[model samples]
Target: MPTPIKMPALSPTMEEGTLARWLIKEGDTVSSGDIMAEIETDKATMEFEAVDEGTVLKIEVPDGTEGVKVGTVIALLGAEGEDAGTVDAAPAAAAAPESSESAQPAASEPPEPTPASAPTVAPAKAASSAGTRTIASPLARRIAEKKGVDLASVKGSGPNGRIVKADVEGAQSGSAVPRREAAGPATGQAAAAPAGPATLPDFGIPHEDEKLSNVRKVIARRLTESKQTVPHYYLTIDVRLDPLLKLRAELNAALEAQGVKLSVNDLLIKALAKALIQVPRCNVSFGGDVLRSFSRADISVAVAAPSGLITPIIVDAGSKSISTIATEMKELAGKAREGKLQPHEYQGGTASLSNLGMYGIKQFEAVINPPQGMIMAVGAGDKRPHVVDDALAIATVMSATGSFDHRAIDGADGAELMQAFKALVEAPLGLVA
Candidate 1:
């Protein structure tokens, strides 16, 4: 008996996947755990593995075929002697057969179907002609096609893993993926954009303009809704960071031999989390009519990846050790840069943090990420003259701005949270405890 291999939903939100490539060819013996193909979900490229031992008997979808919905048969696998084309395949039997081989008796002893079998020998001619490669995401490939971008030239940034619009854009910008040109016009393209604009008659192909990539699409949608629907208020606080600087220096020196360096950002994250525990309102949101507060503080730290900005959550930041937070942040940042963040990994933060301190930004405000009530924008930590005990003293001061959802949090609550955060930074010891 032959079994049909359907495209599995790699992620919760994956409706369809682009069959990026087949690792094994027809007639090739495949075993359980063998990677059959690379699938492109909306989020990332992921490997599709075989759950049952069999031979590649058929492939309905040729490489580069797009718009194949999840649970659609892309390939077939069964015993070496079994002709998949000869297997009785019904509309309902489609997804079931793929799992049946592994779900029940082995290939030699497949359980008889309760329903009568239909004629097995469907001609291989009915199967699509074999292509050189699989192109994932029809929309992405179409975009690439219109832009004269090569599907093979772009690397997929999407999840089990297929190419998406971001991959194409990244390729076009000459950023993530390199361009292949011969000092002349590229193939499948017409005249390029003007280097110097002239009053030449509009001479390019007419096409409808799209707004942005799906990631950008979602970002724009969420941010717009947040700004429009959520009443926002901001509070600014200047933190005396001289104590934090000295403490961080000492902590780094102590931890340097351990191959772990504590960053000021790490300290700040811890401080904010602790302060949120004391100022519970800042750690909460208005769940429409209900006040939804969380016991655990998960801070979403904004990171700019190749795809765009993705905030990887740092869970239980208020309770986690500084070293642990630093380690987790490093890991998340690394994966974020590679666009390997999982959905839950970037979602569901109680609050968010956007730090431009390393970029030497003196001060800036942030838009609140919704459901979560507030966002903290941190500025560069630099030396400034301050009055300490009524005497002038050179100290490090950092400007911190908290953008709060006024619908959920008032000016007093925002100020209280900022005051607590300021005290923590100045003391700089409570955070470590």
Candidate 2:
């Protein structure tokens, strides 16, 4: 008997992923906990592990396949003493239902097919056929359920007349079946317009059209939604960095023997965290009917990766030393670049920080990453003439802009947060304290 290996939902929000690579091929014997495949989700590429030990009997979906829906059978595992080749030849349509009692291990029976995978027959059709079942893939069944479509009325296009994801989606679009609104606070939002034809007008121009990667697509969609939905207001403040720069040099020199060098961004992260603690009103998230205010400052620091920009969080950063923040940030940034960050590493934060000082950008306002109440955008610290005790003086200064979600944070609270952050950065000792 053979067991099916279905595509797993790796992340909470992941509906589908690209089967980036397969570590085991057909006929390869595997043990539980072995790395089976690499799945590329919208956020990161993660290794999928084998849960049940068996010989790889068949690979239903090939490697490098994109948009593989979760719960789709990607492979089959033959039980001990079962011939891998014979297991591969078994009809998938019959294997699912007939092997229910015999194939599965006694300790752990296979999960029953949900409404999405079960053959759904309309009342009239069920009456006509008496006991015939509708055959659909699990993904198809879920989509059918979401769309409120009668599976019996829809035609199956999969092998042996089984309904798949495409079949359910196509059926919904073509039929006049009313769709049930998805249940959530974010429901009722209109679907984004489908991309127009890829054909561009050719005026005898040479160009390359590279496709958007999953990461880029997710970034674009999420950012667009953020800007469109979140009510954003910006507050900018200029902070003289002379004191912070002097202290940073002194601290780095002392910590050099300990193999720790702190960057200005690291200090900024600490400052932001402290500022959040000082002004607790800013460390909050909008939750539709309720506001979520956190006592700890979990800062999400933006890092640019090959795929796209990702924010890896520093949990409870306000309580951590500057050296610890630097070390953790370096490791998290590395993992982010390698696309190996787990969900917990980059998922939530009380606030966000985006620093473009290294690029020498003067100043720029960043969009808030919801449901975070605010984001601090730091610009380059360059030598500039400024007022010092009512006299013009040259000093290293940088502009910091705090983008606040006006819905959650009022203008006065946002300004207070910005002032607190500026004061900490300029004072130089508060960050360490």
For each candidate, what TM-score against the reference? 0.69, 0.77
Worst 10 residues of 1 by lDDT: 119-128
State the TM-score for model 1.
Answer: 0.69
Candidate 2 lDDT by residue in tens digits, 1-433? 6788887877776766778889998889999999999999889999999999989877765566565666667788888888755764676542333112223232132432333422333221111144577866554654565555777777777544666667778774423233323222366743232231233555777877665767887887778778877999999999999999999999999999999999999999999999999999999999788899999999999999998999999999999999999999999999999999998999899999999999999899998888898999999999999987799999999999999998999999999999899899889898887
Model 2 residue 13 CA deviation (Å) reads 0.9
Model 1: CA > 4 A from native: 1-4, 14-28, 40-42, 58-73, 87-213
lDDT by residue for model 1 (1-433), tens:
5777877876665555557678888779989999988775555556888999988876655555444566676776777667655544524454322121222222233322322222222111111134434334555654554455656656666422456666766666322122232222356543333221222355695645443444564566567777877888888988988899899999888888888988888998999999899999889977779889888889999998765677899999999989889999999999887767776788689999999999999999998888899999999988899888799998788999999998888889889999999999999889877
Q: Positional deviation of 257 in candidate 1, in angstroms?
A: 2.0
| lDDT, residue 65, candidate 1 | 46
lDDT of 2 at 19: 85
Off by over 4 Å in 2: 88-203
What value of lDDT does candidate 2 attain over all alpha carbons? 0.80
